[model samples]
Target chain A: MHSIILFAHGARDPEWARPLQRLREAVLARRPEADVRLAFLEFMTPSLPEAIDAAAAVGATDVAVVPVFLAQGGHVRRDVPAMLETACARHPALEIRLQPVLGEAQSVLDAMAEVVLAG
Target chain B: MHSIILFAHGARDPEWARPLQRLREAVLARRPEADVRLAFLEFMTPSLPEAIDAAAAVGATDVAVVPVFLAQGGHVRRDVPAMLETACARHPALEIRLQPVLGEAQSVLDAMAEVVLAG
Candidate 1:
């Protein structure tokens, strides 16, 4: 089975972490066969490298790192990739796919609309 | 004085909320004149409309809704704008500027790098 890592920009309010965790649940609900986990880009515990290590420790040979970010900003373009490079170096046996950052997906946009209207 | 609302994609872990709240604090630390607050896009409390109401209650004539999102997906392009439109309709006196989503900034990328290395 492939292990999936969802990367997010960590928040301080703790409540801010809700959506990302929900998202991880959503992804797991859809793909139960995959080992899904969450990681923070900053300001939270279990950073990406640590999360990746945990996943690897759990015997995940093939891993997909999905950035839960919204844009292709510095995190996506540089930081994420560079992190992957180091993580990959450490886990040479693991097959890693650093997926694209979550941008303006139609479903995500719809979700955002729901938030606006519901609010 | 202008009020600023930082809208985030809420997380379930609460820890996810940290970065955005910290960002708000950072903004407030620099711009004390601005009333900085936070609202979640989903799975959290004090949605955008309610947050706006709170800001309006605090007597902010001009409000800037800065999306803590990353791309121009449906949320940035459509949902957020629609929310602002409704909010504007309710508060005709409020001048709301829907700022662009945070994306691919060199600084943000740098921040991401810091997260990776530090981890």
Candidate 2:
């Protein structure tokens, strides 16, 4: 099975982190067979490298890194890649693929609209 | 002139909030004519309603609510809308439009890919 590593900008507040953790749960519920895990860029536990290593330990040769961020900004442009480079060097055999971020997706837009309209 | 209110999931750690505030600076730098303000859903200072009033006080008739969120989850689908509703009621004359969330945008995806590839 392909392993999925969901990456998010970690938040120190429990409130900020709750939604992301909920999203992780939603992802796994939809794909129970897939080996899914979460990692934070900073300010939280289970950093990307550690998550990748855990995935490798579970016999995952192909891993997909999904960034949970909004907008094309510095963290997405700089830090995440740096962390990924280290993970890749440590496990040269793993086929790592980076998925597009959750931005401008129709469902997501619809969801946003629903929220706004409700308000 | 249009007023832009950026809504972010605030973080307790100064690190997580810094990038978002930086983004606000970038947005302002690009559009100096627009009145841009930052608000948090929770865990930070300067909530959304306060930002809206500030914008109105500055003679902004058209206000855009931008969700600085990644997905179409509960906050985007529920809380934001509810907050908007209250704001709309309080400022009946204001022309408020909820902008499409920053998801799936090419630039954002590019940023995510850049980060991933760099790693």
Candidate 3:
């Protein structure tokens, strides 16, 4: 089975995860059977490695990690890859694909522009 | 004239602002004459106050500050309002409006879901 992990840079405030959670729900809403989960870079539960391990344990043969960040910064560019490498070593059979950050997507940017224009 | 300030949490990596810049360009593409600028919370130029001041100086009677964050963390819930308060005091004549964070918008969330599913 294939799984999708929505990775985000977590904040100290618990409420900070609300949007990330909403995004996961949005994904599941569209594809109810999709195995989607949330993982944080810091200050929250289920770090990248843990999320990957859980996915592997659940018989996920392939996993796509979607960074829920506005841009590709050091965390998205550096830290995430390092964590993925470690996860790969642990689960040699699981194929993990790192998708581009959400903000980098043109559709996401257009949506944001529309929101800004509407406000 | 009204100005739109896209506020983001800047990072040390200069490339971190590219998505934000694209969002600004996207806004301008739809409305060529619209006045839009980017401001950072930290690690970049044109802080929120500076952006607001520049807009006020450019004869913008109103300004819309859009937080390009995925969620309302302390930075958005607290820091931004404090910055806006200071800016309001500095530019009493310029009506400043703080829009909701981009990620909170339903359309943006749906767009993100689409991107996730496409990957």
Q: What is the lDDT of residue B77 in candidate 1?
A: 64
Per-residue lDDT of B12-72 in model 3, one digit per residue for the tens?
Answer: 9999999999999999999999899999999999999999989998999999999999999
lDDT of 3 by residue, A21-112 (tens): 89999999999988999999999989999999999999999999999999999998889999999999999999999999999999999999
What are the chain A TM-scores for all the models, listed individually? Answer: 0.88, 0.90, 0.98
Q: Write the per-residue lDDT of candidate 2 for residues A25-82, one digit (tens) a residue.
A: 5666656687878788877768888999999999998889887765435676677778
For each candidate, what is the lDDT? Answer: 0.69, 0.69, 0.94
| Candidate 3 chain A lowest-lDDT run of ten | A15-24
Better of 1 and 3 by DockQ: 3
- Model 1's CAPRI class is incorrect
Top DockQ prediction, candidate number: 3
Worst 10 residues of 3 chain B by lDDT: B49-58
Model 2 chain A: worst 10 consecutive residues (lDDT sum): A110-119
Query: Candidates sorted by TM-score, descending order?
Result: 3, 2, 1
lDDT string for model 1 (B66-117, tens) is 7877534455566788888899999999988876555423333333332222
